[model samples]
Target: MQTISAPRADARTPVETPAPLLHSIVLDWYRENARDLPWRTPEASPWAVMVSEFMLQQTPVKRVLPAYAAWLERWPTPARLAADAPGEAVRMWGRLGYPRRALRLHAAATAIVERHGGRVPDDHAELLALPGVGEYTAAAVASFAFKQRHAVLDTNVRRVFARAVTGVEYPANATTAAERRVATGLLPAADEVAAEWAVAVMELGALVCTARSPECGGCPLRAQCAWQRAGCPPHQGPARRGQSYEGTDRQVRGKLLAVLRAQHGPVPRGQLDVVWPDDIQRDRALDGLVADGLVEPLADGYFQLPQ
Candidate 1:
């Protein structure tokens, strides 16, 4: 067991070798312990990886698996998705929650077609330029799709690193340059294949090193974890806010969209009214759906999936 000191917040010391060593430990553990997710399969296309990334955001894996398979089957390429109607994309998104991601993914596909000749961009900068592709997403595509050496830091990866490397109970609210520098230090020197390692680590965090009730006993990085070494310190900050689904606008919006998605064209306001009781909240939710471009209003005051 080896220990490394946490760098000062303002310190810019070159990232040390412990990160790569820890990465190797986790990657090797991933090789043996990794789940056989569809996106992780060798045959997964770059487009498939991109779609999976978007679907997995804020959504659970079990919920995403079927949708991911169905989405790829429907649109095997960015060009295929770009050619489809935006409404169709929303319809396919179903009840995955945060339907905005589906629209953003659709927009990203359109951008791919217009800007990158219908190919998912391999370059990090170009991928970042896409509608929904952010730092984590760009790095994910670069590594998973192109096998680039970039560090793909997401919530899972951030927590894993924070615990294993820095002995922190919680990761910062957002990733910083210091985090990126630390992540870059952990990346394998082999520039072409390090992305797999990044995804592997993230998977480990999601499935094993979870925020609540981490299965540290089964975690591969347990032996190297700083937090584990420190007796798994309790999270001391204010408890995270709980999201209310019952009677909330999001629930109302989901119900409204469900009706439109299930039907062919504009559903009557009468039918929409059946989904929720409160007119004010229902109207607000409906207006939000329309604003999000997930629904469109018909001439007759009915609502339809956005065209």
Candidate 2:
């Protein structure tokens, strides 16, 4: 294996990434070891890829699989989903957590139908213009769905770059301009190959370079990893911690939504009040849900998901 140089201070001129070797090793590993995800299939339409990206945000693959299947089964096309009430989208979202993504996806589908004739647009700029389509989601859709050249910097890809090239155990708490430059620099020159490279790196991070308990011995990048070369040093930056779900407002919100989801039509305020113990906390959670458009208030103090 060829020894790649270390990354320099100026990320704009990053020359440490041996693009050819990295692509070769990672892509080969991906071909053999990549998860058989529905979205990665050649038959997966751009709409399917768009849906996966939305659901996968902060949600795990195992949890997303069944929901994804059911979602596509019911609404395979953007037009199909767009035609349904936004409340149905939220209901279909189930216990996926972060129900706001459901509403955003519905809005995006509506925009797709209106703007692009019900087809998910291949143009990166056009994708970015859609509702709930941010930089990461737009790039992911363009590359994965359309095989276009773009740096798809999700958390997984960022962690891979941090350890493999930048000699760090983790990336910054938030994405930096420097990180974007590093990602762009590592991209292959060819559009289709670059798309493959992006997913390969992402897969590498997801499988072998995980945030905790990485299986470094099995990692394709193990030999070339800068963090490994540096003796697998500990994270020197701010302390990393996982978010607590129990007893939090998010739990209360989920519980409140569950009741609304189970019922057919509008639910009375008193029914919602029984889910949580504290009156103040339950009221706050319900109010937050209403403000977020996840719940619609009806006449006579009844509530339901958005119509």
Candidate 3:
């Protein structure tokens, strides 16, 4: 147990988080209310967990469900995915929104096969070293898949903490060192407990303490929530912008990639032209895609997934 101290201004002292109340109430509520997500089950392999992490990024659970199953079915192992072309990975990605994640997951699988014998690394640092894996993803895979004790601060978890503990409507647009430090302090001392708490907090945020229209009356933490006690003030922080897809370069790229994903081999440039009408924007999107390594341009001007 940590020695409780009054608030300090020093960097060494982490800001106090609601420790026992957070740990117990959240865990118990999670056991009763948590959705039976497949990836969290005992049968899911570490690779399955890793793949789920990759597919879940910015994409909704409903959208990712079928893609995750099909992706794993085709390339069950990291080596299998690594052996295939990037185009195949992108193609398998379907309409997952961010096709780049598929490409990065492929790259990560390649790295895993090459460096770690196809096993998703259990160590946080090693996981972070893998392509497409960031601090949150690394910690998530390690703690959730490997049962390591780590603070998994995803968007949902951050929102939960912001409301329940920090008395804020939302966390900063970006994560901060202070936020991480507080998360670390909030972790249960027991490894297994800490691991469970990580997912529990995340599930609470996802299902209950959502970004908008939180079901506070139904929430177990409602009585203890600081934001509620503080009269639920509106967010005074910078505007969190929503992404737009219509007529943007991203939409053009998606259209272009759709043409290629439908084909097993290289497609002629003319096929891509019909996806988008404006020649200048379409060309820019294609050029950006090729430059980003998501699409490959052959000597004959045909396009395909990277070999």
Candidate 4:
């Protein structure tokens, strides 16, 4: 998929303020108000953190809580999940949406078992080499789970960096070298503190510097925030919009997957056909699913979640 190139940072991006002061404020705020997410708990394993990262992509914490709990309870380790059929992962994914993530995660588990002695590797390069892990996931697992001093740039952290330092209402559509420099420059000197700072900034963005309806009045960074100082200027880039799902191909795909997920084995074509009225759209969605390896076509005229 093509992505819009990120604009280079210019004079508008503010010079970062004192790092220690910035760290202290956000870290304190996080200590007081961070959500009691299961992934953040001391007892959470590396595999547990990796699972949470996968489930939390483009998905809210509220929706992920139950699924995360159920998933860990069922397959507590990479070896355990690696032993199961990939189809089982899709079934266990439930209605959290984005079923393809399930397949990638299952594949990652299998790789971990095969190459890392059933352990989720702490090394960023090894993490990135995993099936579903990308730059953000790699940085996230390294920082959050291993207490490494890497810049963990996710949506929330990017938003925080944009508004607080870049004097913008939003980050660019794509992650940029400028954004990485800003994130890296602000990292705390110590590895452990940098890890804590990464999560703290993310928590602040999630709870206070939110996408819509940000509670700036209560934000600890209000005094120094570039966007706030600039009167919270509106987004100057292309019109920002949320993804539409109703009546989209994604919706049709979800419905078809629902039928497959419910059954124990391959479903008849006739049974899958009833999920949508438009045969063209439904067939296209099913074909896309099969092409994506989220579904498998059997010798018989039937489909099922990939084995």
CA lDDT, every model vs. true structure: 0.85, 0.91, 0.88, 0.91
Query: What is candidate 2's TM-score against the reference?
Result: 0.94
Cα shift from native, residue 237, model 2 (Å): 2.3
lDDT of 3 by residue, 16-130 (tens): 4356866788899999998888899999999999999999999889988999899989999999999998888988898897889998999999999999998888999999998
Clashing residue pairs in candidate 4, if any? none
Of candidates 3 and 2, the better by lDDT:
2
Q: Distance from true position, residue 11, model 4, in Å?
A: 12
lDDT of 2 by residue, 1-307 (tens): 3234555567685445457888899999999999999999999999999999999999999999999999999999999999999999999999998999999999999999999999999999999999889999999999999999999999999999898888889999889998898888888889999999999999888988999999999988887888887789899966867788999999999999999999989999989988999998999999999999999999999999898
Q: Residue 225 deviation, candidate 3, in Å?
A: 0.6
TM-score of each: 0.91, 0.94, 0.93, 0.94
Superposing all C-alpha atoms, what RMSD in Å does each candidate have to the true structure? 3.7, 3.3, 3.8, 4.9
lDDT of 4: 0.91
Q: Which residue pairs show collisions in model 1? A: none
RMSD of 3: 3.8
Question: What's model 1's lDDT at 164?
Answer: 79
Quick one: best TM-score, which candidate? 2
C-alpha lDDT of residue 139 in model 2: 99
